[model samples]
Target: MPETVLIVEDEFFIAMDLQLMLEGYGWRVMGPVGTVKDALLLLETELPSVALLDVNLGRELVTPVAEYLKAHDVPFAVATAYDRPEQYGGEVLAGVPNAGKPTDERRLMAALMQLTGR
Candidate 1:
């Protein structure tokens, strides 16, 4: 099966662009959604080989989403503007690596590759 990815970013263009990028690499993407709620719902139905999560989903936090992935042993990485470890509630590396915003093709792909170890 093709590798699947769950995207938890809140920006439309970013998500769309990421989808295109991942698709180009032959990855199946589950979401590029704008809300934490939407991401959670998608998780209930399916799982990806890796996840790309943003730290903030509008007013809500993405920590719970990160927490969920860790609990399930599903590998994931984070992309956020906030660089400090505290901003992520000190969860960086628990399962999520820090991939900042304005992410490029190589950086995002490298992070995803690390998370998948593929």
Candidate 2:
């Protein structure tokens, strides 16, 4: 079965583009969800194989969602426009992979592929 990927990005266009790209590669995309609350709500019902998390969700950070995913053993890649992760103040994200926004499909795919061993 194709793995499902939850997308937690605040930007609508970027999320939609990512959904299309992942779907094109035969992935089941769970969401292009814009907020941490909505993403967490979905998480309560569905467990995705992996997640693509944007560092910032408007004024909020994705650190809490990342923590939930980590505790559940769900792999995730951080997608962000920021060059430095220190600005986010999450030590848990220290060694996690990054997918960098305006995301490059190759890098994103590669990161997810590596995470899932696909």
Q: Indicate which candidate wins on lDDT.
A: 2
Model 1's alpha-carbon lDDT is: 0.81
Over 1-118, each residue of candidate 1 has an lDDT whose tens digit, in order, gives 7899999888899989989999999999998887878888988998778898877777877877777777888898877767674444555445456667988888888898888777
Off by over 4 Å in 2: none
| lDDT on C-alpha atoms for all candidate structures | 0.81, 0.88
How high is the lDDT of residue 39 in model 1?
84
Going through the candidates in the order shown, the clash numbers are 0, 0
Total clashes in model 2, counting residue pairs 3 or more apart in sequence or in different chains = 0
The candidate 2 region of ten consecutive residues with least summed lDDT is 84-93
lDDT of 2 at 54: 92
lDDT of 1 at 28: 93
